[model samples]
Target: MRNRKLFILLCLLIAVLVIAGCSKTKQTVTQPAETPPAEQTTPPKTDTSTPGSGELKVHFIDVGQADCIFIQLPNAQNLLIDAGNNDDGQAVVDYLSQSGVSQIDYLVGTHPHEDHIGGMDTVFNTFNTGKVYLPKATNNTRTFEDVLKAIKARGLTVTPAKAGVQLVASEGLSAVMLAPNAASYEDLNNYSAVVKVSFGQVSFLFTGDAEEKSEMEMLAGSGAATLKADVLKVGHHGSHTSTSPAFLRAVSPQYAVISAGAGNDYGHPHREILQRLSGIKVYRTDLDGTVVFTTNGQAVNVETR
Candidate 1:
């Protein structure tokens, strides 16, 4: 009887040990594999080439012995100076349209010369205009009367573009009227609204047919110290009466631009004026077509088409 009980107990112990081993194998098979870590990466660097400066473009449109300048300000605003001859109205409008300009933030009629403001009426009719600037000078021609009618239609008032007037005064840009100093003058050209625009290190001087008299007055005025510029729009299409030696000395421009027609009757860009600009680089609408000057407050890049 004792041998039979011992045999039964040994058999039961062997069965229990086998079951425990099987349970351990099942747990090992069901376990998941461990995951690996992800790889690291570096980021790209930022561009800081032109710090705190924006692009500014000044377009000198070719109007054939007439004056028409379109400025694309650093603040994305547009400034239109003059509008060319009476026949150039549609061409001027088309050019502006192609350039993606729908509105003019500032409209300037310089003096009331026919070549300067002949198309002013058309411009007023076409674009949505902001501030209108004009010299106190007036003309009795039909061209000037048409411009007045257009102004009345638009309900826009004229702002006198005279000395001490500030057109733009921002952090990185400044445009101030430096001419039309005297209230009255013997010659109408003396009423030309001369403007000085400075952006960063680059500057431009726009003289609207201003003759020697106007230049002399500006030099004697408070704005004489600010006459220095990187680029100069030669006055009266580089006529001898304009761009006097003293005026050129005060400006000290590195580049000079002349707007005149090819083989025109006026004999524009006179020999004397060309001699005066011998040392400086010269660009002419008559030869170079439309010229464009782009700046970033530090450097200026020029493009001609």
Candidate 2:
């Protein structure tokens, strides 16, 4: 009887030891398997917080010899300022399609100049324009006529854009029209629809061919307002008449984008202006192709195509 009891006790001890060993092995195998999934999940969380990754974007298309600026609001709203020259109409259309832009929320023609308003005809015919802003001026050019006809055909109204007017572009973007006041100047460049767009901690100034005359007025009017910007679209393709030293000093942009043709006849992006913009990062579409400015309301990054 004593031997039988001892045998039963030994058997019980062996069973407990086997079960404990199995439990330890299972924990060791399962722990390593569970750890990798946790590590894998951490990367995506880090990626989302990266700067410029989740921010709004602005694309300055290289429509040689003219200007076409596409602003993508944080909410995905679209704003187009001038569509290059007539030759760029089809290219602009193709670009918008590729970028998934089916409609334009706000379309602004800086002036009646062909290079500024010509490609707009194609844009108007192709997409739905919510509001149309144009300089309060007229030109009898066929290109301007075509743009007008398209706007009328679409039943869109032409509104004059002026300073002090503010509108919401997206959740974070605010648009302020800053040119074409009642006080007239002899030059059409003075009438160009200048715009100052602001978002959290960042601001951009778009001078649509506005020359020294308009820049002076803007600076004088905004005395002490501090129009410093993160980005500046070089006025009049960096022409000598635009981007005056005083104006550049007032705005003090961090980066400047020059939209000019390769070997343009007008001598765009004059060397003097380039020199005056010393210490500022410059991107020229003629050399770098399309320039894309992207920001997450904190910092802006430039990418060339």
lDDT of 2 by residue, 35-67 (tens): 998889899988776533345688899999999
Query: Cα lDDT of model 2 overall?
Result: 0.86
Residue pairs whose backbone atoms clash in candidate 1: none
TM-scores for every candidate against the unseen true structure = 0.83, 0.81
lDDT of 1 by residue, 1-305 (tens): 89999999998998899899899887776653221222112222233343322678999999999999999888878889999999999899999999888899999888998899998898999999999999998788899999989999999999998998999999979888998989988888889998888999999999999999989888999545689999999999999999999889989999999999999899999999999999999999999999999999988999999
lDDT of each: 0.90, 0.86
Model 1 segments more than 4 A misplaced: 1-53
Which number leads on TM-score?
1
